[model samples]
Target: MSLAIDFYDETNTITEEQLNMLLELVNHAAIEEGVDAGSELSIMFVDNDRITEINREYRGKDQATDVISFALDDEEEGEVPLNLGEEVPHLLGEIVISVQKITEQSLEYAHSFDRELGFLTVHGFLHLLGYDHMTEEDEVEMFGKQKVYLEQYGLTR
Candidate 1:
């Protein structure tokens, strides 16, 4: 999938297998949505304090957030093919995740840490692909697609 993941924090809570699973999950979603295989995406993991600062700075929210996506492509222009005429990979965007929040939410939702992390990863990936939940209808559609994709990837909780 040409996905590049960078862990911002030194904790290293995510294993290589888990990271591969996430990449495959997102790659499957992108393929199903007709995105090119050469598309490049990045996922970054950070601790609570770091994510809290990011939330405040980027989202104007003082609290910690589970995940944040910075999409590089404009959806309004349609799905752009990655690596079309260039040797370099297309920069899809960055997804920043708070490992602290994932742990907390796993407990809150009564699910395993892997499940929560996988869910959050999928959610963040979707956001990078231009999915949003600004309205009730949008929420339904986005969340439904998330559920479908997760289940298809065997990440169901």
Candidate 2:
């Protein structure tokens, strides 16, 4: 019963402390959200160019976004399970974050880099848990949750 995270830094910019802090924050959020303990996810840090390419290919947006999430088991309620019998870790999905965007947004928002990164990381994680911000109500719910989670993690602006 544990949360397994596969972290990859394509831009080679994220520090060890940042990674550890993000991991702690994610773990806390996962527990609070009641996610299965045996769940897994990946977080990849990339440059602006890489993220822009990914956004264009996958999301049809030719711009650099702060974070993008791909959920593996995004089945709706009452949907059939993909795995059978064995208790394997649920692969939630991958979170792709743009390091350049983090830096840019930190400056733009007049917030610390840690605060920006924490916000984006949790934002992407919530998406993996089936949270979306397409509608006004949905945005309120999702963004509110993000604020609570960030504040709880002591990453407040």
Candidate 3:
């Protein structure tokens, strides 16, 4: 059992090795969160401009944030699409990350690029699993889980 991750890169800020690490990080996030291994996810790396456009179009935000997660499992919200039955894969969601934010935040936070990227990846994945930071309690829980994944993957700052 393994996650079917579809990673797409729209920027060349990271190397292939970085992408491999991201894949492993996401897989670990799913497993640690008790998500089935056969689940699927999609990640897209884009520049600041692209992310800004997405933010504006989706969340009514005019700024370019770090990452955005669009969960596809919200049946109550009518966001999930009806499939052709059991044969269809269990798609978790889509995560869009901005390479520019990764670099800038890494420098601002005094952490390595890898660490920042790992944090963003885990944060995004957790969102797909219904984790959020809208409250202080939820922030602790969500961020704590993210730290665990990053530390286990040697991405600590």
> What is the model-wide C-alpha lDDT for candidate 3?
0.90
lDDT of 3 at 55: 99
Clashes of each: 0, 0, 0
**Candidate 1 overall Cα lDDT vs. reference?**
0.81
Tens digit of lDDT per residue, candidate 1, span 32-78? 77776676777888898888898899889998889999998765656
Query: TM-score of predicted model 1?
Result: 0.87
lDDT by residue for model 2 over 1-157, one digit each (tens)?
Answer: 3589999999899999999998999998998899998799999999999999999999999999999999997688899887665677788999999999999999999999999999999999999999999999999999999999999889989
In candidate 3, how many Å is residue 144 off?
0.4
What is the lDDT for 37 in model 2? 88
Encode model 3's per-residue lDDT on 1-157: one tens digit a residue. 5789888888866788998998888888777878986889999999999999999999999999999999988778656667788868888999999999999999999999989898998999999999999999999999999998999988999
Candidate 1: where is the Cα deviation over 4 Å? 1-9, 75-84
Query: Is 1 or 2 the stronger prediction by lDDT?
Result: 2
Which ranges of candidate 2 are over 4 A from the true structure?
76-78
